[model samples]
Target: MFSYNSALMKHKKIHKGEKEFICLQCGKRYRRRIDLAYHVRIHTGEKPFKCLVCGKTFCFKSSLTSHERLHRREKPFGCLECGKNFSQNIHLACHMRIHTGEKPFKCLECGNRFGQSRTLANHMKIHTGEKPFRCLQCGKSFRQTANLSSHMRIHTGEKPFKCLQCGKSFRQRGHLASHVRTHTGEKPFSCLECGKSFSRGSNLARHMQSHRGEKPFKCSHCGKSFCERSKLRTRQQIHPG
Candidate 1:
C-alpha cells in the first residue's frame, strides 16, 4: 500500500507543480524528474523514439509522430475559410488569420500591422530607419536579415530565379516577375489619365507623375526638373554635350 501510495503521490505531484526529481549529473531539479532525465538525453543525442513502420529513430516522440504523419499524409487541422489543411493546429491558426483579417501583430513605430509578430518586428525597422543587417561586400544595409543574405548573392553573382520563358536569370523574385511580364505582355496596372498600362506598380506610378508634373527626383547640379530620374540624367548629359 505504501509503494502504491508513493506512485499515486508522484503522479499527483506533477499535476500539482512539484519538483521532486533532482539530477545528480547536472544538479538540475525537475517537477517530474523523468522530464529532466529525458531532457538530459538531448545533450547526449540519445534518441529512444523508434518508428515501427520504417525502423527510424527520433530524439523526441513528438518529432517521430510528426514524421509518421508525413508518411501517412494525414492533415487533421484545416482552415474553414480556404479549405487548406495543415498537420499542426498552430499553422491552421496562422492561416485562419488570412480569412478573418486578424492582425494581432502591430509595429509600435509606424502602426503597421502584420499577421505574424516577426513580420511586424521587421516592419518596425522601416519607421525607426534601423538597418541591422549589413552586406559584407558592398557595405549596404538592409532592414531584414533575409535581404542581407540575398544581397550577398549579388557579390557572388548568383542568380537563383530563372525565367522559364526567356532563360534569363535574376537575383530577386520581383525582377523575375517583371521579366516574365515582358514575355506575357501583361500590363495589369494602367494610368487613369493616359490609359497606358505598366507591368509593375512603380513603373505606373512614375508614368502617372508625367501627367501630374510631379518631379520627386531633382538634379543636384542645376535643380533641373524631370518626371523620372532617368530623364533627369539624360538632361544632365545634354548640358555636358
Candidate 2:
C-alpha cells in the first residue's frame, strides 16, 4: 500500500533535519509532535502511562512499554559474537566492542584508549591525582573506581584470586605471585648495594633504605624516627613514655 515516490520524499525531508513539531512552553523543537508532547510532561511531572500488573507509572508511553518487556522476560537484542542477549540495543552495542576490540573513547592527555566513555573519564583522574573512590576498610583512596571495589574486598576478607599450583587464595595477583616465589625460591629483584636479591620490589626497597639509613618514618608524638613506618608505629606503642 506504500508508494515508492512518497517514501523517497519522506526520506529526503528527514535528511534535511526539518523541525515540524515545536513546543509552545519552552520553544523546543522535535521531529514528531508526539515526542515533543512526551518531553513537555517532564516539566509538568505528568505521568500518563500506568502499569496494570505492578502499578508502576511513567511520564512517557515509550518508557512504560520498555518497562513492560521486563515482566515478559523479553530480550530483543542478541550479540552475534557471544550469543548474549540484552534488553536494550545500546547495551548490545556496548557488548559488541568486547569482541571487536574497538576502543572509541580516548584520553586527551595520555592518549590511552578505553571501550567506554566512563572508563576514559576515570583514567583522566590518574593524571589529576583525584581520589574520588575511597576504601571504607582503611580510609585509603584511589583514583580509579575499580581499585576502590578491590579495596572493599579487603574489609570483607574476600580473596577472589586463587593460585592453581598450591590452591591458595590471595587478596591481589601481586601477593599471590610473591607467595609463589617463596615456594620456588625465585628472587627476581636484586639489590645493587649488597648483591642481595629479594622476591618483591617492596622488600628490596625496604632493604636498600636500611643501607642508606634513610629513616623517613617519623613519630607524631615525640619526634622519634624509624626506617619503616610500621616500625615507628610499633616503637611508639611500646615506648609511649
Candidate 3:
C-alpha cells in the first residue's frame, strides 16, 4: 500500500490526459497553471531567464540552462552509438538516427522521409515551390536557408573545410569528406551485383547503369538515348558542329 501526496496527485492529471489550463492567446492547453504561464510568455515575447555569462535571454529557464552549457563548453549528453557529445539531449537523440538510419519524419506531399522534422519541413517547400531564402548578390532564391548560405560561400570564395591529411580545403563539408576519402582510399559505396566499390554514390549509380546497359537520358533534339547526361550533351555538341 502506498500513500499519494497532494503535490504528486496534481501531476497525475498529465497522465490522465487532463489539460485544464488553456492559453488565451493560442488556445494551447497545459496540465498545470505554471506550464500555461510559460507558454503565454512565448506570445508575449517575455524572456524572463537571462544568462549571466553571455547576457543572452531565453523565454524558458531550461533554454537558459542549455545556452549556459555552450558558454561553459559543457556537453552533458553523450551518444552511446558513436561516442559523440552534445550540449543537449535532443541533439544526441537526433545524431543516433544517423547510425540507425531511422527516418521518422515523412512528407505527406511525397513519400520521402527524413531523419529530422526540420529536414522534412525543408523538403515540403520543394513541393510548395516556396523559396524563402534569397541571395542579395545574384537575386537567386532557395527553398532552404542552408542552400543560400552555401551559395553565398561560392560568391565569397570561402573554403572553411580543411583536410588534415593534406592542406587541401573545400567550400562544402561534403566536398571535403569526399576529398578526404581520396587520401584514406575509403570506398564505402559498393555495387551489390559485381561487388565493385566507388568513393561516391554518384559514381556507383553510373557504374550500375553500365552493368544494366540502361540508357535513361535521351537527347531532346536528336532522340538519341545515352547512359549519362554528359553523353547526351556530347551528342548535342556533335549535331551543332
Candidate 4:
C-alpha cells in the first residue's frame, strides 16, 4: 500500500490493467503518459538527456546514467561467489550461472539447453537453416557475422591473433590458443576415465572414443568406422577399387 493517494491511484491502474496512453506511430499502449513520451522518442530521434562530461546524448535519463558509469569506472554490482564486478546488476546475475551451471534458456526445436539467451537464439537458426550473414568475396554464407568476418580474413590475409613467444600468427583466436599450447605444453583437457590429458578438447574427444570402443566416424566409401574423424579422413584418401 502506498502512503500517497497519487501513488496508490497509479498502482490501481496496474491492477485494473489500464493502458490509457496509446502511441499513434505503432499503436503500442502504456499506462503512464511519461512511458508513452519515452516510446515516442524512438521514432522522433529525440535525445534530450545529455552527459555533462562526454556530451554523449541518450534517449532516456536511465540510459544516460548507465553511460556515465563507463567514464567513472564504477562497478557497484559485485558477484558474491566469484568476486567479479559488473557495472550492471543484470550482468552480475548472469555471471552467477557459471558457478550454478544453470541453463535457463531451452530450445523447443531440439530440447537443447543454453546458459545464454543469445546462444539459444543462434542455435534456433540451425533448425531453420538460416545463414543471414554472407561474404561478398567468395559468396560464402555463415550463421553468425563473426564467422563471416573470420572468413573474410582468408581473402585479405589478415591474422589479428599473434603469438608473442614465436611471432606466429593465426586467423582465428582458437587456432592461436591451440598454437600457444605447443609452446607452454599445457594439456588442459583430461579424461576422467584414463586421466590422459590433451592440448585440445577435440583431441580429448577423439581419445575418449578409444575407451568407449565406439567408432562413430564411418567412411563414406566403405561401411567401416575408424572411431575418429581424422582417421576416417585418412582412410577416405586411399580408394580401394
In model 1, the worst 10-residue window by lDDT is 232-241
Q: Once superposed on the true structure, which residue ranges of model 1 sit more than 4 Å away at CA?
A: 1-87, 191-196, 219-222
When summed lDDT is taken over every stretch of 10 residues in candidate 4, the lowest stretch is 86-95
Decide which is better by lDDT, 1 or 4: 4
Q: Give the Cα lDDT of each candidate.
A: 0.85, 0.85, 0.90, 0.92
Model 4 Cα lDDT, one tens digit per residue, 1-241: 6899999998999999999999999999999999999999999999999999989999999888878888999998999897989888778878888889999999998899988898898899999999999999889899998899999999999999999999999999999999999999999999999899999999998899899999999987877898888888899889776
Error of 3 at 202 (Å): 1.7
Between prediction 1 and prediction 4, which has the larger TM-score? 4
lDDT by residue (tens digit), candidate 1, 1-241? 4469878887787688878677777777898756887878867889999999999999888888877886898998877777898887777888888888999997766677889877788887777899998887788999998899788987899999999987999999888998899989999999889799999999999998888889988877788878898988887886754
Task: Give me the candidate number with maximum TM-score.
Answer: 3
lDDT of 2 at 79: 93
Task: Estimate the lDDT of model 1.
Answer: 0.85
**Cα error, candidate 1, residue 63 (Å):** 5.6
Give candidate 3's TM-score: 0.80
Tens digits of per-residue lDDT for model 2, 1-241 = 4479867765676789987788888888887666898889987889989998899999977788878878888889999878999877777888899999999998889888999888888888878889987887688999877788778877899998888788999988778999999789999999998899999999899888999999999988878878887898887897647
Runs off by more than 4 Å, candidate 2:
1-16, 20-28, 40-76, 160-241
TM-score list, all predictions: 0.65, 0.50, 0.80, 0.73
lDDT of 4 at 195: 97
Candidate 4 segments exceeding 4 Å error:
1-8, 11-19, 22-29, 42-47, 50-57, 71-76, 211-241
